[model samples]
Target: MSTNKEMKTATASTLNQHVHPFDQLTGDEIIQTAAIVRQAKPEVDLVFNTITLKEPNKQVMLSYLGWDTSKPRITKVEREALVVILEKVTMKCYEAIVSLTHNTLKSWTYMPDVQPMLTMDDMFEVEELVLKDEKVIQECRELGITDMSCVFNDPWAIARHVSHPGREKRLMQALMYMRTCEEDNQYAHPLDFVPIIDLGLKKVIAIERIKPRDSKYSRPTIPLQQHNFLPEFVGEENYRKDVKPIIIQQPQGVSFTVKGNEIDWQKWNLRISMNYREGLVLHNISYQDGPEKRPLFYRISLSEMVVPYADTNTPHHRKHAFDVGEYGLGLCTNSLQLGCDCLGSIYYFDAVFNDHNGQPVEIPSAVCMHEEDYGILMKHTDYRNGRAHTIRSRRLVISQIVTVANYDYGLYYYFYQDGTFEYEVKATGELNTHVLAEDESAAGMGTIVAPQINAQYHQHFFTMRIDPMIDGQNNSVQQVDTYTLPYPTGHPKNPFGNGFTSDYTILKDTKEGQQNACYETQRFWKIVNTDRIHPYSKTPVGWKISSGHTAPFFAKDDSLVAERAGFAKKTLWVTPYDENQMFAGGFYCNQSGGDDTVEVWANREVQDIQQKDIVLWYTFGITHLPRVEDFPIMPVEYCGFTIKPCNFFIANPALDVPPTNKKINHSVLAHENSSKGEGPKSCCSTKL
Candidate 1:
């Protein structure tokens, strides 16, 4: 290959007075002319310019030209006039050579960084010399034969070809060309050269294109679009207003007594009242009625007056009549006992009655009775002076009542060893059944219970009672009982309030051993935000679209079994054209106060448009699953997510921000012509 020093020396040697263009002058005459031009154009700086000339039979002629090179000015008027003459001569040279050789003369203009080579051997390998020269000559010949006289006139094209496979070379050539062109008096249309130079830039550096010898893998595919969509509940405002209110009422006829720190009940009874306009009946109530058979025929209903209680303030305590009416006679042996040797028994039964039309009605019921030995209740007894010992005594009290829709529906009563009676009842079927906690288990028992109960009578009713104790011991137990009725419509065993569907989709499988309690892995329903005071139309909607290329990925084990990873990142994508939006991991709500900006190409000009048809693309999610070897120092994976417009914005609100065009007068660019004295004769006046 030719070196810079050798090429520069050869070029200078070629500047002889014997050359055709300068043959009109002798050596002494050339020196005198040069001195005269130098003296007249003292401000001008001189620089050497190279040009390549081709002859017949693969011959090349390298020539040099001298011109002014002052700050911001390259040539004197004399040099400018000479350049015009030289351009015409060069055109003529092409025309004249057309007849001598079948090949046309293609002008290969390049930047200052392009060294002039006299032969193919100077720039290419010996084996490639003939092929490269032949290809160039063949192309020139074809152009000449076709009358295409302006073939290969672009300086950028020549520079790109010379810098092929070398990005650094291309950059150097581009920079030098821009600098030289600006300094030359031949600055006719310099701005038009930008695109030509950009076209020659290599897409990838040579170092990046190298492949590992043992690798045999293809690149991964990347999706062009991804976005996230968060759905909200619709009609939320109306649902909150329609739910019924529930009030907690206190228990009645309930009393407690303590004597010498021990309980001693002398009597026990229970009472219940039903206020349904029509008589009621309950079914499917069972218990150890007599320890012989599970008979289900015990039933009753309130017909008239409220059951009265004993008049005495102290009353018989446990011996009161209201106790009988409060605590129904149904009980079963499975019921728990409080004190040692208490031996409590529980029984279950159902109330049956008839409506105004005599139709059958039934409701499930349960009751428990205790029969403790007197020895347990006499725990604190003491003898003083042998005069009929007496120490302590206590009493047990219990009461319960349940009402539903203004109808008395449940009742409970308890008797204490200390002769106290307690009666209580409460309203039923008024409870909020949702609002689960995050760590709730799938078993449906937690700090709160919201069983989904429907109004349809035939639909099975389910209620989960968390005892937290069972089998006479504190063995935690969660019992879920389901009951089915025959009617099509009836009162709900449990009410539904704050109507809202719990719904969501799980993008990944639950981690092993995750309870997934109140933490539902899937979406049950869509939620929409309707609380905005204004209607949907009044709210401005906008979407921003963006796109980006992701970083390359590689396998964990460095195994060739898997394909070479390309841009595998999952990107967030939003489409204003379509309602669907997606994010790499999953769609989240489009609420504000987040990383709001979308990813876009670094060059903003690429997305300029007049309408709102922008689609934003974001990459996120796991690009590759980790392998065992990827443990300790796990390689970082590339992932990205984005949020973009979802038909949520009105048309260009920023249109009136500013207009971008401005005009300036070029008269300020004019300068006085100082090279008039040093004329075109300088071109012929050569010092050789």
Candidate 2:
């Protein structure tokens, strides 16, 4: 396939002035990149999987950003594209680095015995092929699926279930589903059979069922009962009636300034970008303290995540999904609506990715940004004069939502006025269900949410990659845990037996940095800059990482899910900053045999990691047991981690904020009558 599409070339001066070091590759840039790669390899037909910006070297980019004072400010940084291509004939993968700045190929290396992530076209093509195959039609007909128009399937990455045949081929297993109508929810009526397809040959290689057609364990017919959440099916009158109209408007416009991808809101400043794998990413995060800009993190993102189901059945045991690596979050992102996804004055950003044929695909409004009122920041009251001082709290939120098969994940990044950063994942969608046969027990494996539909137990583990710039580049991690005194009642240390102390341990090496969350001890890790001393506290300036709900790897040690998802086995991992070591689950994890992951990288050596440029890999998750109410649609489940200042700031950073004023707030008290009560009359007393 010849990619001879014409692209308008920009002048060198215009290109250098517009493109930032961290911006996503533009559409024109992507077209130019594919053309350059085709010119270098004219003899071979290449299919493009990923064509993204190859970020400049960290130190050099830092110098350009003026972070490195020792080196002169570098002006012109080369724009490079990291392209992954597949040979259509041989089915071999290759990683190429093309210089978009010079319009030349830099290097190309063939990847041995590996498969790239499944693209949107790959998923759609397999579904089409399976629906047309005679074998699949006959199998479905036997299961009472007479009309194939209502048949549906979800293409999932085959992690490592070697018990089945065809281990050498690039494959995907389609979990079959059937809907009563076109708009019906398919997950609520899952079929019993699964079709395995060889992506290279474009054919259904094998078919696996829950049990033999004559066996008692398998259900012979698809569940015809309708379970749907759409408005047309649920009826409009069934919706909530008490939800009043809440209008959020900014007459003076947004409080933030957007110049390209960088945003400056209140005292916080950061740049946001999106790619195919990690979705939304924050870069060059910092805060403006009066005239000084205090850098907190160089980059932060949801590096990788896995959803492993707990059903031990043959085909069901291979249900683990590497959402980030296998099917990129960016590719699955939804175009958010205005008043639904985000309210108030909002700013949106678009994402650019490549299709199978090396063409640019843009998902417009892929990111949503806005400010929200969060109750109160600080409050004080004096009894003497009945005077009060209160300051309203507000936060800046950058978020995106992605739908991966049965789950819709809403990823949000929040920045508060008190110099705190939060990352939250909201999981809500249709739960993956299967129709149960008579006398079949889902006791240990899953939960029967409906009459006969079973939703399996599962866990969603997320690995967040945090590269801190605390006060400077040189940083260290200290594991801090609170413990009660172990002395006797008569001893001098614990005379009251209520005494508690904190144990601080500086993680000196990679081995020592692999720590776990201890809830009994109230454990947390602090990323500190030893070189920067807080004069008042006489300690290192630092930020603390506080995680929410966490769980241990539930899969057995020798299981395929456990072997491939090694990053979820530990809660925290610290390693010296290396640009190439970004993902916790390695570069390619679609059909990975569980090698070259974060677990391997952290244990490669006992190198000293103290007082150096370091990155923190935090893995946190939730163990989900499907509920009866989670059938048609599941409510949002929240899990996240927070980063707060721990002596990094001399005092409360938000102390300078103006007090809450009735004139600006314009809030009214509700009353039984038509008339509304005016807000508090006294406003001057609440001034800060």
**Which tens-of-lDDT digit does each residue in 1-688 have in candidate 1?**
1111100111111344232221112223223333433343354342111111111110010111111122243221111001000111111111111111122212222222222111111111222222223333353343232222212111111112222423223221110001122222111111111111221222112211111112242211111121111122123453557566322111221132212111223332222222122112121111121232221111122211111111111111111111111111121001222221122221222222222121223333312222322222222222453222221233332222333211232333333333222222321222111111223221222112111110100000100101100001111101111233323343363243323332222111111101111212221111111122123556222212121222222223222101111112112222221122112111110111111122112121232211222222222122222232222122332222111222222332222222111111011122444433332322112234
**lDDT of candidates 1 onward, in order:** 0.20, 0.86
Off by over 4 Å in 2: 1-17, 163-168, 212-218, 672-679, 682-688
TM-score of each model, paired residue for residue: 0.14, 0.95
Model 1: residues with Cα > 4 Å off, grouped in runs: 1-349, 354-358, 364-411, 424-688
Best by lDDT: 2
What C-alpha RMSD separates each model from the true structure? 49.6, 5.0
| Candidate 2, residue 565: how far the Cα is off, in Å | 0.7
Residue 228 lDDT (model 1): 12
Residue-wise C-alpha lDDT for candidate 2, range 355-446, written one tens digit per residue: 97788898877898888999888887888987777788999999999999889999999999999889999999989887677556685778
